[model samples]
Target: MVFADGTERPCGGLLVPVTLHQRTGLAAQLGAALAAPTPLTAEGLATPKMPGETSVRGLFVAGDATGQMPSVANVIASGSTTASAIVGRLTGAT
Candidate 1:
């Protein structure tokens, strides 16, 4: 259905019909729609984080936004870390 370049194959009669009962595992199950929360900030996307914060304050990023690891567990960790950073910044503890 997809190529390494990230383009769709246009079906080309290659698509298969699968039912919920027949499917299994992560790929078999329905996946949540995911996308970057926002475009690159003024700092743009250099690495792990935005400039310091995005153009919007109180907003932070984790997971895919950093363009690093893309595993579910890694994203969860990133979110936890980002949340802590935000809390600290808000409470003047950072």
Candidate 2:
């Protein structure tokens, strides 16, 4: 998915297939990077947050960046759990 800065990152391990809409210069560069067949690095795994605190308040992080889970399904589940946690925190139930 596109990051806050519009940088599109490839989520490895076949979680979801990407469709190239426009053959822009940046897209071509990403295509070349993927074509190398080398293992994708974890260099850019950090989340791009909006200006303010380190993370969004009351919204805890999970999955890859948070070192929780790496799989797609796990990430999805973590996101759901995070949402629940946020709601709980907001409602003073947590």
Quote each prediction's TM-score: 0.42, 0.38
Best by lDDT: 1
Lowest summed lDDT over 10 consecutive residues: which window, candidate 2?
A: 32-41
To one decimal, what is the Cα RMSD in angstroms of model 2 from the true structure? Answer: 16.1
lDDT of each: 0.47, 0.43
Tens digits of per-residue lDDT, candidate 1, 1-94, equal: 7889999766657544321121222311223222233322211122223322433445555654544444689778877887778878889976
Q: List the residue pairs that clash in candidate 1.
A: none
lDDT of 2 at 20: 23
By TM-score, who's the top model here?
A: 1
lDDT at 29, model 1: 28
Instruction: List all candidate RMSDs to the true structure.
Output: 13.4, 16.1
lDDT tens digits by residue: candidate 2, 1-94? 6889999988765565432222233423333221112133222122234211113343345444333335799778767776677677779875
